[model samples]
Target: MLIFLDYFLLFFHIALTAFNALGWAFERTRKAHLILILLTLASWTVLSPYFGWGYCPFTDWHWQVKRALGEGPLPGSFIKYCLDGCTGWDSDPVTVTYYTAVIGVVVFLLSCGVNWRAWRKSHHTQSSEIA
Candidate 1:
């Protein structure tokens, strides 16, 4: 049961990270992308100031599960963690965090821009039809 819980948390963290990075590419996930961007912004602005710049709630919870299961110290960056697992490369957490932040900002802006354009197009069409 505990092992299963740890794996579940691990999977959740990975999926959420991927979704955060690439969700904007799919129209069906645009809404989810907006919510994720807001959540991530809140985490960075509101929670990070209190917890730390690289702080992530999902990662924190996942680490807690790992510790409970007797796993050793966890990696600081989620991207670094995944990369280390796959390639056995030791990555700097700070560098990974910086890269992640850059990617996140780009994706957030893209998601917002795409959604805003869609909203405007729909509104314009509606106004034209009403005339």
Candidate 2:
């Protein structure tokens, strides 16, 4: 149940980021676009690795969360269990990285879409005045 909940939250957060980025892209300057690009990368790292749930059986920070909730530290064996889920010896690191890159790319493309929409709208308004 906890596992399901954790992944659910992770997906939802990513979705929200995509949505917010789209909205902001509408009115951002070039600098803002750069900032958004960097942020999307940062989020990918955090959400996909030790800090996030990207490739581990348990998220890298799951132990911390469990500890903070008065559950105490997870047993070493349990930690291994979670890590195994995310990165088993049989798992291909290349594959994992590919998935991570894909996520980042998807967000980046969405940002571009927002910017294009805004651009087109502005272009339309300007052209209408010449007609």
Could you give candidate 1's per-residue lDDT for residues 48-108 as a string of tens digits? Answer: 7689886788778878888888987788766788988999988888888888889888989
Error of 1 at 42 (Å): 1.4
Model 2 — which ten-residue stretch has the worst lDDT? 74-83
The true-versus-predicted C-alpha distance at residue 118 of model 1, in Å, is 0.6
Candidate 2 C-alpha error for residue 5, in Å? 11
lDDT of 1: 0.85
Candidate 1 TM-score over all chains jointly: 0.94
Which stretches of model 2 miss by more than 4 angstroms? 1-38, 43-63, 67-94
| Over 4 Å off, model 1 | none
TM-score of each: 0.94, 0.39
Candidate 2 backbone collisions, by pair: 48-54, 55-86, 56-86, 57-86
